[model samples]
Target: EHKGAIAEAGGVKALVDLIFKWSVGGDGVLERAAGALANLAADDKCSMEVAVVGGVHALVMLARNCKCEGVQEQAARALANLAAHGDSNNNNAAVGQEAGALEALVQLTRSPHEGVRQEAAGALWNLSFDDRNREAIASAGGVEALVALAHSCSNASPGLQERAAGALWGLSVSEANSIAIGREGGVAPLIALSRSDAEDVHETAAGALWNLAFNPGNALRIVEEGGVPALVHLCSSSISKMARFMAALALAYMFDGRMDEFALIGTSSESTSKSASLDGARRMALKHIEAFVLTFSDPQAFSAAAASSTPAALTQVTESARIQEAGHLRCSGAEIGRFIAMLRNSSSILKACAAFALLQFTIPGGRHALHHATLLHTAGAPRVLRAAAAAATAPLEAKIFARIVLRNLEHHQTEPAI
Candidate 1:
């Protein structure tokens, strides 16, 4: 409330002005001024006000001009905080659009000071949400800088490790950037980071790997970097639901037939060993994927949804099984339809994963749950769910999740599309 009052009283503009005025010489006061803006920027209301009061431009100036590590760290942090106000704000684009902001932050990622490096990586990570900013950062050498950061920070603080991997993860969202990351010797570091005991570090690493795995070459790089077992470990053992989910997705993408030829790579015509290894990896991945699905299953709760069509039981199960953060994940109708098609896959493991992903998306209270449900409903997904649930060959977990998805769709049948 006091923070809100500060913004109301024009404190943000005053702070921005103070930073700019004192930043003339990289004075000690300028660092504190920028730090104050960073703190205020953590609040959504104040963050928007900061942008309105010209704080974005002011902070960018400080970041681009300040030579002191202390000032640079604070400025990058302010930029990151401004960029992270729970999303949907224009601050992200503002930061990216601020001339020299992305370059300055990218250069700061190479800072000798860990705090400066961490904050810069974080700023890049947040800004990469925008497509134009994402590619621009890569063009600014964000891919190489961040991959190097990821490699060198393995022994650094978890914050640095997480942010380093996160920056790469953000850039890897694009196919070109993903391929660039893999080719720039990023796969090995990310795989090593994925084995970190820190949940956030491993989670970010898994996310990057997931994005990179979209490219068959990168997927093969992950395999060659010994990422398969690491990803499988994350899918089975990570405490974070997002980590497990993305790890499962990464594994799915790897074994999803596109990498079939890559898995057959060998030095000579005598590639029997490679074929055997591929078969074993597939079985292991499928087994763990099935196990991941079953982890969310409670026979008693599922029995309730199975017994009646009412939403009470299904809602209860979804609530119990829901990953609250996953609700924030939005996908295109084509993406949702891909999972619907997967329900007919001959591989029961893929079918189960598809159902599991659908359940995650349509859990009712997610930011995009309604959007996903509408997409599924429009795509005629209910028919697929019914067939999947009734198929004798379907895994029990898949059958159960498919029924739950059907119930979720039914509950939304009368609601207006979001």
Candidate 2:
């Protein structure tokens, strides 16, 4: 009846009384009270009542107590609910004066129980959503704690890893947290997690990588911390399609500005040689386009391939062609080169990929290569047509690919001097 009455009244007074009991009474009663408070706090009415009855201080106390896992989780959840209201127009001043609230929440991130830790991480994420709270989290080693959790929990439950990684990801997106991630030895663990056998782990790792990639300095750290190799391996992993896509998308992002860095891998003699020694090994990095094209045999696979490639790299070549003359082409050229190399099993899909990759090249020299390749196709160049017709099994798509190839060449064709 008491529980039902609390629920009926939206549980405000009961939650407040329970939180008071937890704070002042302490022990079995506190645990029961904390749980009741957590349940009641789920309703704004009850949460408001608890807030009025010193619930914030009580929850903070539970969070700081090392022996109370159940209490800490309940406290974290209650605090999360309260902080979520910090954005309310009327409660701004009240929340601002909730001294030690942020500190207590940060402490819960270190809770022995994963549930409390994840909830704490989530609450911290919500709190840091505010610029003011972001500064506070940064000052209180929140980023460091989140990153540490991410690293330590890499092999734990995928859910816990994800929550920790997601928190780190959110933190890393901020410049302050990005630096903290680097300083706290977080990049290596994220890179390692990116290579995990679990799809969820890989996705969380990818998100973390994406957040870190937002900063050029972090991108460099990712590379120096051995992220590149792990990402490259992920690109070719037969594990989860989503993981592969994320790997590809991330590599594409890295290559956007760090094209030279990729040159070391793409143009490596060992990669290009494709010697008998690697006969049974997975396809080399230079052959990524070929691998992508092969996957097009299945529509689902094609969709996966598209998802994996960067959107910036997916734009029509004709569109990118105009600006291809600048630094744009340099990046495009590398992508096109890889696309061409991947076009071994030619089809309209392969042609489109090749054209899109080539379109990024605007330099006269790059255009000359594209022009040459196109001409060979126009002159009924068997190899050129075959490469361009990679997706030719689909007739309409094939015809379109042929037309695009011819038109691309026609635009580049240099007429004899008058």
Candidate 3:
């Protein structure tokens, strides 16, 4: 309430002044201040107001130099909030200023203390969302630092490795950062993590692979370098239920990425600013998906046999009576159409996954495959969408999972003409 009053009393400036004085006042004061700043930044009004007061610069420095790891964590969090808010505007100048702030953050990414470095990597990722910050991060050698962190995870504490892998995954999602990640030897480390004995390490590795899969070029490398087989093994593994579930979720995203790229291929499309890269990416993605399907279809006789030996692991997959595995397991139009039909079943999780899988077909140049193959149109999709929307408005537990469905429908709707 007092914080609300401070925010209401004089807007963002009051909070900014308080944060700066408290943060720079010394260890205890800085920690207290960082806490307060985090609270304020959580609210958009306060965040935008704080951004107005050179809050970015102060938070970045605090994140860099603060001795107390807790204070640094809070400061890093505040920076993430601020960067998230600023990057949303698409304002070049605002992003450029934030880029300058990221330079300091990159330094902290290599901090002697592991926790501080983790927090710093997360902060850099938040800032790097925008083009300006992406350039800034690349310039500051973020790619090298993140890769090194992932590599050292084997020797580092489990908690530190988890944090480090997560940060690298965040950066890997962006196109600019994807190139850097590849150049910095991140792929091998990420693939290696998929097979880590630690559950946390496995989850982090899957998350990184999901991010890298966003770029079609990386998908084949991920498969050739053994990511898909490793992840498939984990999904079918009996080691840990949670790890298997996460691996399944990550593969869902990777599969969606491949389908999305395939849909963008050769539509005789007029060249737009996005034409070159998008088209190239689509071809690469199609090749990767073809290879993945070939291997996944016959895992026992596939190229990477070690990663495919998961019959023991397959028993661990908790299958619901309501959800049936695709018997034909083909990527043909009829197969996809049947999959969409399965989504309308009463189970929210089933519906959500189906909706997402359907979204992959909406990209463009791929309409012909579905047109002849039994894919559902927008009219057929709305029923599942309405179910998801209703679920999203229900109580919290039901809401989060349902939101995923709604988001997939919305993403597909954004390019309706395609």
Candidate 4:
């Protein structure tokens, strides 16, 4: 299947030929052909076949020249499906690299038809995973378009809300785009969307908010827009563990003692009635974050990591808490260094949060775990981790995570260099 048997089976060439021959007339032939390719593009194995058979050029032609909404939706869906296989193939960047492909998809986001808009946004979302495509989409006015979509989609289907917010989430991974999204009024709709009853909607919205929260201006904007309580709700109640985890991280970054300067909490003089409400919001965020981390801890497994000499025991403990998606989270060495510094910070909550972030980054088998472990090792983290583990005042979870980190370091560093 991965060999793209469709080409051998002759199906891919047939669909591509049909798409190339059909014009954008009233007939549904072109639409059906594009739609069939779209369906095939969703299969990882068949997707390459479609591409190899010149399907991308055919689909991009339809996306560009076709006036039919049906054809447009199918073409965009096919592009989205094609871009979805980035991990296994080059389709993500390949889609964007196609002539007029990125701009065409960006145009499709403004489609009057909701289906076209959703598929276009999803294609951009998937495309945004590629570094070049992420910046390219923004250059194509994607930030403003997506923010407007978020604003207008308030009453639209949950599917629309999810994609609109998701597209923003993908773009906001970059610092510049994160700020751009906030300045373009992206944060308000995301905060609204985060309160949705739809799990997919709020989960994606929470992700956008999480990235947006990394910037101080956006963090304060979130607070000004009443995003604190919304995030607090997701952190405490979301059925999706990833949603809860991200909401907690957003709050952590907000409360990591960085935003105290604003009059949001109180003026420099410190009002008798503090407005920041840091006491309750910070407490709630930390409580749930700690809870989220502990959910992965098995007392029995941790006992071995904590007491035994076997590296496998520690590896078990580390993997026990592994959130595969968290490994995809990229943090600079500066961020890792800051976490090391937080290990001995005055508050145990910050220490625990720091430990949690490091644990996520250092778990064995993660995409970036080895990179993170290397950073930790170079920072002379073992001594600091030993201190955190032995600190009399450290929270139990913090100490547990610190030990896990130490063990993880011991385990990964000793591996044979490839």
CA-lDDT, candidates in order: 0.87, 0.57, 0.55, 0.84
The window of 10 residues in a row where model 4 has the poorest summed lDDT is: 267-276
With a 3 Å backbone cut-off (N, CA, C), the pairs that clash in candidate 4 are none
Tens digits of lDDT, candidate 4, 1-418: 6336655779889988877676647449988888889888998878988888888999999999898899999999999999999889998888888999989989999999999999899899999989899999999899999999999998999988899999999999888999999999999999999999999999999999988987878987898798988998898889887788789778877877666555355455564334446566667777776776677778898777667767687678776777778877766576677678778777787788788778888877777778888888889999999999889888777888888788778779897764
* Model 2 vs. true fold: TM: 0.56
Q: Which of 1 and 2 is the better model by TM-score? A: 1
Provide the clashing-pair count of each candidate structure: 0, 12, 2, 0
Q: Residue-wise lDDT of candidate 2 within 1-418, one digit each (tens)? A: 4544675675556655666655644666666666677666555555566677677667776777536677777777766666665434322233324677677777777777788887787677656545666777777778778777877786577767766776676566566677678778888888978877777777668767765654556665776677767877776763665455445544544434343343235446755553332222222332553354244334443344334444333224233223332221112233334444433433333444344333333223452555445435444544554455444354333333343444444445664422
TM-score of each: 0.92, 0.56, 0.54, 0.89
Span of ten consecutive residues with least summed lDDT in model 2: 323-332
User: Lowest lDDT 10-mer window, candidate 1?
Assistant: 262-271
lDDT of 3: 0.55
Provide the global lDDT of candidate 4 against the true structure. 0.84
* lDDT, ranked from best to worst: 1, 4, 2, 3
What are the runs in model 2 whose C-alpha is more than 4 Å off? 1-10, 40-54, 65-67, 81-97, 112-115, 233-246, 258-418
Order of candidate numbers by TM-score, starting with the best: 1, 4, 2, 3
Q: Candidate 2's error at 157, in angstroms?
A: 2.8
Best by lDDT: 1
CA-RMSD of model 1:
2.3
